[model samples]
Target: MSTTPPRLTTASGIPVADHQNSLSAGRRGPLLLQDFHLIEKLQHFNRERIPERVVHAKGSGAYGSFTVTHDITRYTSAKLFAQVGQATETFVRFSTVGGERGSADTERDPRGFALRFYTEDGNWDLVGNNTPMFFIKDPIKFPDFVHTQKRDPQTNLKSAQMMWDFWSHAPESLHQVTMLFSDRGTPDGYRHMDGFGSHTYSLINAAGERVWVKWHLKTQQGIKNLMADEAARLAGTDPDHAQRDLFEAIARGDFPRWNVYIQVMTEAQADTWEQRTGWNPFDLTKVWPHADCPRIPVGVVTLNRNPDNYHAEVEQAAFSPANLVPGMGYSPDKMLQGRLFAYHDAQLYRVGTNHQHLPVNRARCPFHHQQRDGAMAIANGGAAPNYETVNAAGTAPSGFGHGDPGWALHGVAGRYDERGESDDFTQAGNLFRLMPPDAQDRLTTNIAHAMQHVSDDVQQLQIGHFTKADPAYGAAVRRKLADLREG
Candidate 1:
């Protein structure tokens, strides 16, 4: 017998011919169900689309590797960094946070910078955003906060009225709101923007020592942003500009990279700072100033390969804050806690109950768990029962080992709402003051242009909030928008 491969066929191995054309009456008449080929093609085509992600809906991703350049063994005992010069295969997705699955890639919104590292121990996913802080710290308001960013239910159109109304009442949003209206909001593309964990995470060592840390992935390409005019034109001319840029760059061997850094604060330092300065270390809406705690470079992540199949690799990729490897752990940040639950739940809804079985989200190394059966469970679970605690089967160390390292907890638990000592306006003011004069002019003008679309009352209210951030900020915005007539 010849060594040639089996004959090519359709998914059911029913052998296909003339795939380029559908079965029709004289190649133009209505097709018949007897044409199995045509029926099969149409059936698959109808089911090609799946439910889109609820957030970070519009995105682009690539496959890559993260090589550890520096040893951070003192900070974490995770096996991924146990040896020097260790490299972990990674998948990273960059996305626009507030838009729908079909929204323009160039929208002036925060981008999701989520990374999944297939380490020897387990899959470690760091899901974050382009900006270092967020609009709210409390988890209770998160749903409403996101709703305001989304389309109004009745009109099904993005509403500035809803966004401004909610944000005006919650002054904590002033910091992020200011950043969103600035030129940096419309980044040139995914490659040129910075990424941050936003919330503080904990790191524990082999010796059980723990420290609070915030992860920052500074773009090696440097920060580049688009002006309102350039972004608007590109959105219409090439809505997929960022996605195409990433794919073409990687194909041309021009890999994009980012230098990963961590701002570490020791437990002693946290206690001392809290006692002396009264600042909560776990506040999600504020940043730990570089002056207070400097960034220590950890490693570099370079994306050198684009996904072969976008839907299988990129769209189905699932990431969550709960996918913690040893040495890395969670914090008490309420928003982070909420996301720990929300992200996985969303993945289940969007990608199926056994979404982790997909190649993009699957662990590279062997993983044995009693997770058993769910819809679309493709992996072989063997003859073992899905439930745990079987005396006969016997458990032998599996599933990321065990729970995270312990940390002391205090204070009486009750219905208590506490505030961090840091002011929202200080950082926002700092950001505004750092911009070059022309950039400041552009930011003011951009805010004026967007505010003109909103009602005058809302515009005045937002201007007042900007005034609270800084007198110059408020005055500049007001000066630019004065030409708009109030009816």
Candidate 2:
């Protein structure tokens, strides 16, 4: 092998004559158009950035492996979980939901926990958040809800009034509103918080029997959170605190791990679960009671390697709930159903149509598709037929299999309002009542601090929802708001 340094060259492999200076007609005159290398460099730099994610704009990611610790074949036939001690290559990205790409890592927002498992069957993407529940249950309310979290269109600033007003009107948001005001909203960093497949999903066994399941990842490092004041201080002092912590910890070989568990409910149980608990089992805003459906250990996820290039690996890595292996399937969760379409569409627009050809997203197992050319078609099906008709043999691809088992659906096909259909406050009240006295104090105090700048009418309306959840809960918030206003 040659020991000499490699020569610098243009993208087309022509040796670069001079990289430091642009080719010019004279020493200080106009730059020459014939300078192909200079033009190439400038053009690439101009398009260097793809559009940032509308949500989860700021994030940190690492390559990891998930080792199956227990047998779950009785529940799912996914090859990655086929046997005990099986390990699957994985990539995990942790992110803050509402912040911009340059926003502070310590912002009081729900953290995104998106995991991708490269199984022999295909890539299984489990996209979720640190919390088990979300602000809304349906997709139609999603854009409006996100609008509240974002800047006010007229003022170009985040408005507390907007958030409060929206939440007051959408009483369903009370559950996640309670959570957001709690310490969990301001996690210490990426390594210390739990992750959940907040949406309910389905698991199909070899026998083709289906069961509803929710995924959970409990951090092995244990839960740690920052106080509101401390989080604010760090946001100003070190905006990239969480990103830095994750990279440094992995660099120093102190890899973070999470024990993966899933709560399973049978089709029979799912049918009556809502009727019994007064909570829709498929509601994204609700959580399955642990007492009713216990967490069963499945595996351990250990993130051991940090990405070498943030943009290439971390930023470009796209995950969708739609990317599921054979055993895994979707549920009737409205938020999840909406995400199934939105996530892939976002990637197609942001990352180009051939994003799956990108190294970070490419499937490990052999994949054959009739999908033809699009922008940046890196690996167009070379020489092979792009249509199924050319096969003549009429045999489908190896990995291709029958679709998921279907379930009965009975509902009027109309825009039915869910606000009055479900008992939203009971669960929110339960969560508030579950907190200890000090935690309850902190929760109310946090809510009051956030509501300080909101309109009185909006505040009163929100307080009423809280009161319905638990009278003491609303009373404490009302008192705290009063104290804040007076002082």
User: Which candidate has the highest lDDT of all?
Assistant: 2
Tell me the lDDT of candidate 2: 0.93
Off by over 4 Å in 1: 1-8, 16-39, 272-278, 390-404, 418-422
lDDT of 2 by residue, 1-487 (tens): 9899999999889999999999998998999999999999999999999999989999999999999999999988888998999999999999999989999999989999999999998899999999999998889888898999999999989888988999999988899989988989999999999999999999988877889999999999999999999999999999999999999999999999999999999999989987788888999888998999999999999999998899999999999999999988888899999999999999999899999999999999999998989898988999999987756777654332534567688978888787787898998999998999999999999999999889899999999999999999999999999998899
Error of 1 at 467 (Å): 1.7
130-220: candidate 1 lDDT, tens digit per residue = 9999999888898898898898999999888888788867777888877887888999889999999889998878776778999999998
Candidate 2 similarity to native, TM-score: 0.96
> Which consecutive 10 residues in model 1 have the weakest lDDT in total?
396-405
Clashes of each: 0, 0
